[model samples]
Target: MNIQLNQLIPIPLKEKILQGSSDIWNNNVVISKGDYLKIVAPSGTGKTTLTHILWKLRTDYTGEVQYDGCNINGINAQVMASFRQQKLSVIFQDLRLFGHLTAIENIELSRIKSATPGVGAHEVLEMAETLGVSHILNQKANTCSYGEQQRVAIIRSLVQPFEILVMDEPFSHLDENNTLKAAGLIEKVCKQNNAGFVLMDLDEDSYFEYTHSLKL
Candidate 1:
């Protein structure tokens, strides 16, 4: 599904954002299906806030956000839930995993929630192995290190079926090698599904061959 943003400026950051220039805030922009879009945002620039808004985790913002030409504000909770379960997936910066669940369990939760059939358990294992997190699949999420948790979260997001992926600083805890591995896996998944992604990061990198780049 294509995502359209029209004059979207967070109320909490309005004054500061209005005083500056941005390629996203208060601008008309379209993230079409299968497009790889990168948003470079520095600290205190509402980067996380923007991610939340797009995922419908927050609505305390001005203007409109549309999915496939339908205004998100007009969508009921049931429809929104359907969209999230089938059309959208996200890799949050904070890695919102169930602390009490095992790494594989966390991944399993997402796999079972998809409206479309998700990857099989064997495929999940293959993904974990690719990202070098297979060894920790049985470990509790809270017991894993930050990097391990991040890898688990990435696996969780990928197991689900989605048309568009939204990621926020998804590789902050990894080294160059792991980052590339994770990026490769993400790209492969998106390609296989003919999907798109919106990634917001503090700095720029050659992680993916981005179709568009915007400053926020």
Candidate 2:
């Protein structure tokens, strides 16, 4: 599967984006399977908007976003839900975990939501251990630190099946060491699933051996 952006430009951001140069806005770009892509976006750019567009959470944009040649906007609700369950996953910049839920519960919710079988509870535990978040597995998400919640969100995103994982500033809360640990886990998971990912961030890093690095 591939995500092809055909001259995508957000409606609300049209005037501002038109005044600038970007490889993603108002341009055609293809993100093929197994391609690790890094999008370097400075502040005031539509980095989060691009992530939302790819995830089908935002439609206030011109042009087309296609999945395997089918325009995403044309995908019906039920089928689009299925696509999200089995093919597409995302980690938002906000680390959208349930505040009332335990860290493990948050991750388990995503794991069980998949139409296809995904990581089991034990595997989730292993992932938590790898990310140094195992200690907070039983803690309420609201009480965890930002870095801990971010790691939990990362685990949540990986517990499901996905052909392409779209991430927006997934490591903004973590230190360099934790960021690298999370990246290593993401790389391992992508390779295991033969999956690809598009990571949008503020600056460039030597993360995941990116196949394409673009400015947004």
lDDT of each: 0.93, 0.92
Model 1 misplacement above 4 A: none
What's the TM-score of every candidate structure? 0.98, 0.97
lDDT of 1 by residue, 140-196 (tens): 999999999999999999998889999999999999999999999999999988999
List of clashing residue pairs for candidate 2: none
Runs of candidate 2 exceeding 4 Å displacement: none
Give candidate 2's error at residue 171 in angstroms: 0.6
Locate the minimum summed-lDDT window of 10 residues in model 2: 112-121
Best by TM-score: 1
What pairs collide in candidate 1? none
Q: What lDDT, from 0 to 1, does candidate 2 have?
A: 0.92
Candidate 2 to truth, TM:
0.97
Q: What's model 1's TM-score?
A: 0.98
For candidate 1, the clash count comes to 0
- Tens digit per residue, CA lDDT, model 2, 1-216: 899999999999999989999999999999987999999999879888898899888999999999999999889998898888888889999988999999999988899985565677799999999999999999999999999999999999999988899999999999999999999999999998899999999998997799989999
